[model samples]
Target chain A: MSNKARVPAVDGWFTMDDEPKLLASRGVETGSYFFPKNLAFSRNPAAPTEALEECTLSRRGRVWSWTTNHYKPPAPYISTDEFVPYTVVAVELVDEQMVVLGPLATSCDPSELSIGAEVELVLGRLYEDEDNEYVVWQWKVVQ
Target chain B: MAVEGRSVSDVVVLGVGMHPWGKWGRNFVEYGVAAAHAALADANVDWRDVQLVCGADTMRNGYPGYVAGATFAQALGWQGAEVSSSYAACASGATALNAARAQILAGLCDVALVVGADTTPKGFLAPNAGDRPDDPDWLRFRLLGASNPTYWGMYARRRMEMFGATPADFARVKVKNARHGVSNPNARYRKLVTEAEVAASPMVSDPLRLLEICATSDGGAALIISSLEYAKAHGVTNPVRIAALSTVTPSYPNTLIDMPNFSTDSSFGVAAPERGFRDSIAHAAYEKSGIGPQDLDLAEVYDLSTALELDWYENIGLCKEGEAEQLLNSGETTIGGRIPVNPSGGLGSFGEAVPAQAIAQVCEIAWHLRGEAGDRQVEGAKVGLTVNQGLFGHGSCVILKK
Candidate 1:
């Protein structure tokens, strides 16, 4: 399996302390979320960290809309060229009066996703670069 | 404001054209040419007569571009018309429209043509090649794996949680737009989508389902615009006068985490942030036209996702935040209702064509104002408005009159 891909070579960002990691920037708005400094990742690399606050409060929203990652994320996202389907869901949070983004577990399928299904947030990785798995927040139907 | 209804430049739209949006196998230039030609023909003017041309650009395709001025000029047979290209994500078309209006208003051109087209690649649109640690799109992809839909989902979830908007409410919007899409000859998924169908759509991001979301497509849209005097000299008396074209960038200290690829700005940066991004766009238009949202008979907003449409309602002052749902559900936002919105299927129905989408929204208002829209016409759509917000804080809005 061709695991490591030469994505790009660039400067990495860091916080008050820690070494910079490889990063890809666009215009400004860097190191905000996707490309946090290595300091942030080194703090808790294994799990998804909340940016502002993670309200354990459950939100009651019917599924607003959804799309399936029928094909695995393209090149830079995953290690293999193989295609895998991942359901991407958008659930309306009940009380927060806002929305959150996340990925569906790989076990989900397009046929399985329907509108108006009560859903909740799920944090996981889409794929992994050899050094670290590309992690982000996603959603799943809250059975 | 206008106590006696003072006049502005009053540019008129002569013609509008668009390439049918779908998964067409073609390059962006092809769609652009088709729409440009259609606009020229619709205007009853020859391509050679066009004095200026502007194109909206796509970043995925715009990296290291040769300004696309000559490329698009060549695509439309290279009549040597002045050309310009704009890139502002989904708002590129509107930005290009702004450039064309500016040139015409500045007396730099007689009749200007604006065109925007895009042939989107399948799957989540990602950042460009190479690692620019400072680039926000790249950082988001690297850190969050939060694809474009993630941000859309975030707003959707937030809206529901913050407000009492139900998923069923969001589905109603999809159903309404899908019905409109089915009638639109240029829309990608034109079948009438049902609320139940929207409910049944599999979850792609979270609460958002497949049917509820708008898809990326290959298409083009174009417009032919002329200063009022030019239109009158060209044996035209009545035309859709674009009273104002406003394109404003977002101010600093924006709280909303707009880019799923990146987090909200640290706010610790600069003081006296200019203004909220979306408000600035509308304010610029109002400044130019000397009119407020109260004068708008109808509007077309960027509905990249259903929830964003609600945000626009607040931004444009259609109603207060969290009140858009009440407004929509009350049928106050319908075609015959007060302050009708998205009467032309919107991005939800027509699909996004990058540079062309914004221009196309204006075309819809023009058509409605001209009393040409067959079914989705807003009644007495005089003094129409079109508003759009693009990535990187780029935004646009135009006020029009007959």
Candidate 2:
């Protein structure tokens, strides 16, 4: 097997630019990405002060929908004995009508994913498959 | 039982009709036209009298980018009353219903017709065309082999573990709905499904068998609704009016519904999520109509699978959480029972018709409230509800009255 670390079949799903990153528009946007090889990582592009702005969107949406996953994904995804459930949210960006779906922080729950709740995009770990760790994106409650 | 407080001047369902739901092997547009004509005839109005047309779209229905309204109107003879199309997964039909009602209520049009139709492929619903790797629905199927039933299976297992519901309880819902569907002339499965037959059926997903799951089929449903004043002036008295239309999104348990996606949010790390997101659709309706769940003589919920029907029971507030199985076992959810759910045989008997299913739910409620349903009538039934949740978290719950 080639020893070069891979993005794990995910780089094919998104419409990435130099950074090989998409704003999570299509296919699936919930998987977390391990950094260091964004193909084009630009820190503090627009909002220099924001912790998440350089990584993803700037305070993208008022939550469109949300959910807490108390169950782990099957093998090849999560090896934890029923890994701790996470939250998945579909946030409609403030600038666009786009709805981005992803996992919420491990601490999030159902009460946080209401119709008109406020949500912000942040970089987080989704899960891992085999050898190389699998990193992905996520949403967190602004409060 | 009186719950939601509804507007007395709400729009009335002037007409409702449906093409038989089954494997008809016809294009979706053909069914749309047929159902539209049937609705016009039932409403005692000509098709030319329709002022606005709204459509719920099927993904394969030839919309370059999913434009449903114009596609359906052109098929039905473009007399051009304002037209639009909407998509909300399974909630498309209910979304269409609400759009038509809004236009009439907003005085944009006095008479409006809403239609939803589909000629679905057999077996699992395949995702959008080809190699595009970003769709969650598509990724789930291609990667994890999580077909639709897999989602249903996870939910079924969760319900069993969390609510103490048994597989047999899920089967009872199918048995009850099939018994009711037998009376519906348009229902695909007219024969009753026995509990034993369901148990004997081959498993599609664990805890759910082939019989326990609903099939995909072709169907068309239409509704002609008008301002309450317009109905009265047209000499159409006692029309079944739409008192409330609630299209809500997945909330609490919505947290646990992760597939082809990574782990669910850790509720153990934080406070539990709210149980109100899904349940509030009907509750919101009750608040608008002043009618309680007990006041609803009948209900038509999206039973994509038998286990899902149990979920709708709690969501629609028909029974307390975990009590759905008890309610089904006691026949409280059967026809002639206290609150007959899916009296038109529901999707269990109807199969998955995509766009048309939610509208069909309202159509059935209208027939029951009007006493026009000869065999499947809910005696003294005055209030009824229709509930469904579509793709991308689009949910709906509508309340109607005679």
Candidate 3:
């Protein structure tokens, strides 16, 4: 690997460790979970005033649904000179009982994946500059 | 518990009009003014006599689009009318219509006008140009490259896996809608499409081909409504009336994946809603108007993708879950079928004009109810419904009757 610093494309959204976990928020009173950490307020209307706490989501989950994106999405998505098609999957977290979306890992074969397949979160390169590599959480099919 | 019949809150639709859907590249104000004039003439109401103007907001346009009510009023020569502007993504038109309906029902205004128009960019609707990480609409694209079609593909894939819906089943929806749109004067594409043609189109998102998805278009639609008493006083009798207008938000713990969001509401703490968000939109209208699915003669549903139209078949209570494909194959949803849908050709033929779409749905339904839809008319149609949902939790269902 080249000598370059690895940084999150969007900070504080997920962990950078080998076993990356999505950072989320859970309502203290209602036990509801929110990905990307809903810091403003509890989204669960049943407990409108419940306090939220920082928590990590389940790393492994089943593929709830998936699609292969053939076209290069428009920006804020940082793109390279050449665009490569990628697979996107919505995974249902094992414990949170909610679905979260992300791209599939670069090494995985999208053709082999299907709904109800198990997958785990891992950090993958989104884009890169001369000095630093930008990374985001991606889903890797579990062998 | 369904309410029996027309309640005192019903508002009469005096007139409806629309600018033809296309990529005309004109200022949205031009389309809005044109549609407004047509509607005013149809209603036989002077512009100066309108008491309130409700405008559906379009974000793609400039500042004037945000204050659309005042903009349209000023474009129509500043009639000093009370104005309101509403924005709810794709549901903007329905939200604006609801605002006008509420004013008429509350006795605040005897006559009100609702208008929505948009001038869209050519390709996939991009988020407002910026590098903001906080916005979910941007984050979904930035983090996962999840364009709107990505969600449509996923939903189509789910139907394929769970309900055994095939690509051919999806293609049939396009063919059926194209056939209906052939006679529509205002539809951007007034032609027939075959299943083979749809199959030959390039795939944009996995199972969804480019032909199966709708494009963005420039168009406008407007409605003139009044209190029932106002219609009677104006020598108009038996006008088409809006029996129920449901603009309801999703209940908590929504599990279905929706647009512009990375995650669904967690059902860990609370039970999932009895009816999913999409199902509840029409359910509320049926409950309020006492017009069950069996009573609907025709429907104008949002068909952003062909497969989604099949999903709406179940969502609107036309068929049970996993039965939309069978419903389409049986030819039950076609023009002469049990319940004709998207008789205006839906977004499949017209493409989408964003803020103007929901109002256009109502406009199509009004035409059939008034026996003015010409060749595409559903004979002896007395009642119709329109359903559409926007990004976030904005969704509406409107039931109209003669």
Candidate 4:
């Protein structure tokens, strides 16, 4: 694992260093949060022109909903040579009261999931190339 | 309740028509032109007399397809008619309908023709072409491998956990819709399906079987709309008039996770609206039309999945939250039920033609209102409604009365 170079599928979404967290933007005045952070504009009607501040999201949340895919999705989604079904979880951030969606940890089983179950963020590989591993933030059941 | 301080003029649906839903493997233009001609004939109006044309655009066919209004006009032998095109995912037809109604209400056009058609590709739909990472539509699939059904599955599972809805309940929706489809001549799947058959079908997404989800197909639908005064002048008395049309967007701090968005807007700063986006859509229509859910004789809704049909019942105010399953189990939503829904078999039987299905829903309502629906007619139908939601958080509702 140490020999393989790691990178995010999309840059600036999360960090890989110690105490990793999902990166996001929050309204400085309105106290609202945005994921895949809106760099161009703020959507708050109360303060339409307020400046946005970058912040890392809460590390833990609860499962709002969950489902598993039995069929491979069509492109531009990358997949493996030997296809395997995967699960997606919609997690509600405890602090923000917002729902963020992501794939569950690859090793997690769908049968174990239930609504309101505690979950935490962890970086996992989505796919890989010859030299580097493509990764994205995923949700895992808190043990 | 007529949308306080706004005096809105009424618009009438002069005629409605459709090209049968199927996998015809033909040009979408052929379907659009054929449906337009049928609508014109149904209204007893000449094509040359139309003052405006509005088309629900399709994205699959490239440039000419995106410019659907002009393409359809040229194919129908153009007469210099004014044209407009609208694209709103599944709600495209309603968007086109709203556009035409706007023109008529504004006195810009006395008569307008609206058409929507599509020859959809088989299998799951892909995002629009290009390598723009910023597009959430692309990012969802690219990073999480989240297909459309994946989202539906999440909703189904959540409902099941919250409401004690079983898989059998979901299968029952297919059984009911398929039965309705058998009576619909224009339906793609005309054979009735059993609950056992639905359960046996392979799972595409957990909790949603292949038979329980709608398929994509090629189809077309068109409507001829005019001012209420024009209908009267044409000697058509008691024509079906459009009572209200609501096209609303999600309010700020939208809590529900909708399509094309990776995360929902945070409610931390402000309180979320009491009603979700779907409820607001129906509320707006009811407010504008001065009609309530009790007044509706029947309805047609977007049923992308069997579970979704149940969701619509609650969203459209046909029932209270978490009671849609009870409404279904009571046989209250069947064709002969107290408030019949999807008598045209819905997307379950007709499959999705994207741009065309919403118009087809209105077409079904028109036929029922005129007492022309042969086998699937609702007896003494006086008021009908259609509800549809498109990607990017567009919700549309239309109410029609005879």
Instruction: Judging by DockQ against the true structure, name the best candidate.
Output: 4
Ranking by TM-score: 3, 4, 1, 2
Candidate 2 C-alpha error for residue A121, in Å? 24
Q: What is the DockQ of each candidate?
A: 0.11, 0.05, 0.87, 0.88
Candidate 3: stretches off by over 4 Å: B1-9
Cα lDDT for residue A116, candidate 1: 63
lDDT per residue (tens digit) for residues B143-218 in model 1 = 4455676677767866877797889888877776766656677777767777888888777766677776677778
**Model 2 clash number:** 46
Ranking by DockQ: 4, 3, 1, 2
Q: Model 2, which residues run further than 4 Å from truth?
A: A1-7, A12-143, B1-8, B250-254, B258-274
Alpha carbon lDDT at B186, candidate 2: 94
lDDT: worst 10-residue window of model 4 chain B: B1-10
The lDDT of each candidate is 0.68, 0.70, 0.92, 0.90
**Compared with the true structure, what per-residue lDDT tens digits does model 4 show for residues B165-206?**
999999999999998889898899999899999999999888
Model 3: docking quality category: high
lDDT of 3 at B159: 92
Let me know the DockQ for model 3: 0.87
Candidate 2 per-residue lDDT over residues B325-355, each given as its tens digit: 8888888888878888888888789898888
Write the number of the candidate with greater DockQ, choosing between 1 and 3: 3
Over the stretch A98-127, how does candidate 1's per-residue lDDT look in tens digits?
Answer: 333345645445455565677544444456
Candidate 1 CAPRI level: incorrect
Q: What is the Cα-based lDDT of residue B36 in candidate 2?
A: 90
Q: Quote the lDDT for B33 in model 3.
A: 91
